[model samples]
Target: MEKTKPMVAVVDDDPRLLESLEELLESAGYAACCFGSARGLLNHGLSHLDLLITDIGMPGMNGFELRDQVKKVRPELPVFLITGRHEIADQGRAQGISGFFRKPFDAPALLIAISEACKNRDGG
Candidate 1:
């Protein structure tokens, strides 16, 4: 049987970042789902996601809030936090996350981490 691609959901207010991340995740063999807001992602539901990558600074629900909401249901899903703000990164709010990356983060490193997370999830 053929294996399915891992579905990775990304939430960010910036359209450019969403587009870039979607492209990057697709290029790296993940099935990407991009949301402009945390509400959008939450509305879509988390049952199908293999992983999540969200930006810290958003209009309404920030990444941390979104992560907390996700954990309430899909606690085992790997979450990666990304942000352009150095202060938020320094605040040490990245608890219970699989990984954290600053904006303009290295794509190769992100891909490797995603690969590892997906592999681990599949028990491979």
Candidate 2:
């Protein structure tokens, strides 16, 4: 039987970034769901998502807030944070995320991290 692709949700306020991430995720062979805001993601529900990658700085909800809400509902879900601000990375705010990436991160590395995260999720 063929294996199903993991469904990953990518949330960001920037339309360009969302499109870039969607292309990257698609090229990596995963199913990508793009959301313009945290509220938009919430509207879709989290039950079907295998992973979540969200921007740390958004217009309203923000990534940390979104991560907190998601964890409250689904603690086991793997959520990764991406930030354009270097200060945000220095603040040590990434508490319960599967991984954190700064802006202009290596796409290959992100793909490897996603693969590893999924493998670990399945193994445990």
Candidates' C-alpha lDDT: 0.90, 0.90
Clashes of each: 0, 0
The top-ranked prediction according to TM-score is: 1
Model 1 poorest ten-residue lDDT run: 89-98
Where does candidate 1 clash, by residue pair? none
Please estimate how well model 1 matches the true structure, expressed as its whole-model Cα lDDT. 0.90
For this target, which candidate reaches the highest lDDT against the unseen true structure? Answer: 1
- Mind giving the per-residue lDDT tens digits that candidate 1 earns over 1-124? 9888999999999999999999999988889999999999999999999999999899999999999999999999998989998666656545433487888899999999999998898898
Candidate 2 per-residue C-alpha lDDT over 55-95 given as tens digits, one digit per residue, 9 for 90 to 100? 99999999999999999998988888899987676565455
Clashes of 1: 0
Model 2 lDDT, full chain set: 0.90
